[model samples]
Target: MTLTDVLDDWPLWGISKQPISANQISILEGGLTNRCYQLSLESGEYIIRISAANTAELGIDRNVEKTIHQLVSSLNFTSAIRYCDDENRYLIRDYIEGEVLSDNVEDMSHNTLSYMVEQLKALHQVPVEIDLPVVNISEKAEAYWQMLATQQPNNEILKMKPLMQVAMSEPPAGDFCLCHLDPVLANWLYTAEGLQLLDWEYAGLAHPLWDLAALFQGIKHSFQQLEKKSKKNSHSEIEQNLENKILTLYGVSDLVAWRRACMQMEYLSSLWYQAQAKKDSY
Candidate 1:
């Protein structure tokens, strides 16, 4: 709904105690699967994320997002959610103020990477009670493949689909913990208190390396995106030595295995983009 549409309903939507005359809201850009609006009122700043059409088909479980957000908030990793719609159409949360990390994605410093590794280590230690679904490359690739069954998938993507099965069958380096599968740079915010990761839509149980791998791949993707924006013809791959340092900081022993895990994440990321593109076409 447009801001005007939302304002027409006013307090009827239960946004705040203030009436429509007192309410102030503006759209926040960079939403991939939902529409986000920054709402300022007499109370405080909040973010209201309006769900997109057919979001469920993207394999996002709003219930899991609520559970993970609750835990992460207690750990001070993100702002607390103020409200979540009963039918999963929307959610309201504290609009955190900080430097959105996407602005620095292409030239992220070593210190930032180190800090992120430390936080990820703490996150991996969080206990998981429920049987959360695994967001492994094999499972997600297949699911996304089925979602795009009618559409013509890219030739490269078709070839990469079978490779995920091998990674899925291999024994993981460690047990599963809560993994944030989508650490895309846009969801990151560097705050004075600490690093704040927003958007827990893809949180699930998975190998710890999955998050690390996803981070590595996500960073590289940001660089590519920057190059594309400038219409550049060539771009170098993210330095393997830097990836090595990230693994070393994370205490990864099996370099070969980690590379394989990174490949799995790379494939899954592509499939996810393809699926989202297909969804948007509708």
Candidate 2:
């Protein structure tokens, strides 16, 4: 179906009368697997997210997202789901009125960071009854490497396989928790109420540090800022500042476990870049 057809059929949106005012439909950029539009309506604005090509290949499930949005909306850590398709694919959510933390980090004060951390902690605190897919870091790293292997071999890319071997050799000690597997800066909204996290396509039950590591990996900060901002209660100074903050927020005591999780995420992300490069080259 066409994008408009999909929108009109959305059960949650209740869109009728052919979208009378559509001039304000602006594309919100910056994601490889989804094209999001800020769709302004006569009643209110809604965020319409359409999964891009091969989303299934990347392990996305819209049903899972619907379940998660329902679960977390109960905890008040995220925006409520307005509508979704039968496949848990296309979703329309209440347009969270705030700036993405990435768009205005300088505007975010210390209070903002505390609020963001609390929201993450709330997500981690959710009970584990839901049988979400486990995002096994080591296995994901392997898939990433296999994707990379299809590309022009770089020494750094080749090193990932060895890294995966080492990472998988030992198991982390803690049981997995509810994790927002992709906690990049853009996914978080800093509003007056605090930080409201968005997008659950990558949500899963996984190691807690994985989210923090992913967030820290994407934040554009220098080493000096990293040192000054690192939390004192974190397991080690080696963990990135954001990861350290997350660990501190969650009261994590095992520094080694966090390190291993971060390593796995780093390997997985590198592999993704390599795979994308190979695809572009062809």
Candidate 3:
């Protein structure tokens, strides 16, 4: 269905028959499994997210997402939700005015990293009253691998099995807390108010270190990309500094254990994207 059709049936924050002009709506980029659009009106700017098909197969529950959004909004960590349709899987929230951080970790300043760490600490402290599931990286990776095998049936993909098995052998040592499983650079917005996190599709109770590991993995990946393009190991200093700060903030002194956890999480992330790609192709 078109945006117009969806909006027409939208409860619209209690405004009946709200007229939305075509020019007022602009599509937003980078939503891998959903359609995001920025809707401008005299009322204010808002974001409307339409869920993708078969997202349930990936373990995303719209109801849980809505609950998590509401809880996070109450903590002032996320944008305000104006309306949500559980049945249709459409969500409307106030648009955040800020710059989405670049995927390159070298672009992140010390101040930005500090702010992100602070926000993460606060998020991890949030009490878990909601029935959020604890994220099991090994299980998720295995499930994705199975799905991909059915879809593509390739050797390269099968190669991940042994690696995943090894990663699962040694579990990360950390307490379970509310964690944003996917905190990629795009999901963070830097604003005048502070750093705001967006997208909670994978939010749940998981190892507190999982989020920190994800951040480190992002920086490492960005550094590798830079090296590939420049034929030099650039951005190593910045990446190391950021990693040190994150480790200090999270109180993780065991570098080897930390790196192992990050590697496991990164592997799970790889499997997830591969599965998503296969699903999209079908």
Clashes of each: 0, 2, 0
- The better candidate by lDDT, 1 or 2, is 1
Q: Order the numbered candidates by TM-score, best leading.
A: 3, 1, 2
Between the candidate structures 1 and 2, which one is better when assessed by TM-score?
A: 1
Tens-place lDDT per residue, model 1, 30-119, is: 888788889887678888887777567776788888888988998898999877756776778888989988897766788888888888
Residue-level lDDT of model 3, residues 153-268, one tens digit each, is 87486876876676575667757889887777778988899889999988888876778888777666767787898988767776667777888876788777787777778787
Q: TM-score for model 3?
A: 0.89
Model 1 shows how many backbone clashes?
0
Q: Write the per-residue lDDT of candidate 2 for residues 1-282, one digit (tens) a residue.
A: 246766567444575445434585888887666778887876677787776554554555667777888898777677776777766557777788887887665454546666666667677878978777777655655555565665556647476577556756454668778988777777887777867888777788877777766766766343334446674433234334555566676677898887876676676676666666645310
Residue ranges of candidate 3 with Cα displaced over 4 Å: 1-4, 15-17, 103-106, 159-170, 226-232
In model 2, which regions exceed 4 Å deviation?
8-12, 149-166, 169-171, 220-247, 278-282
- What TM-score, computed on C-alpha atoms, does each candidate reach? 0.86, 0.79, 0.89
Whole-model lDDT for model 3 versus the true structure?
A: 0.78
Model 1 bad stretches (over 4 Å): 1-15, 21-23, 153-171, 228-238
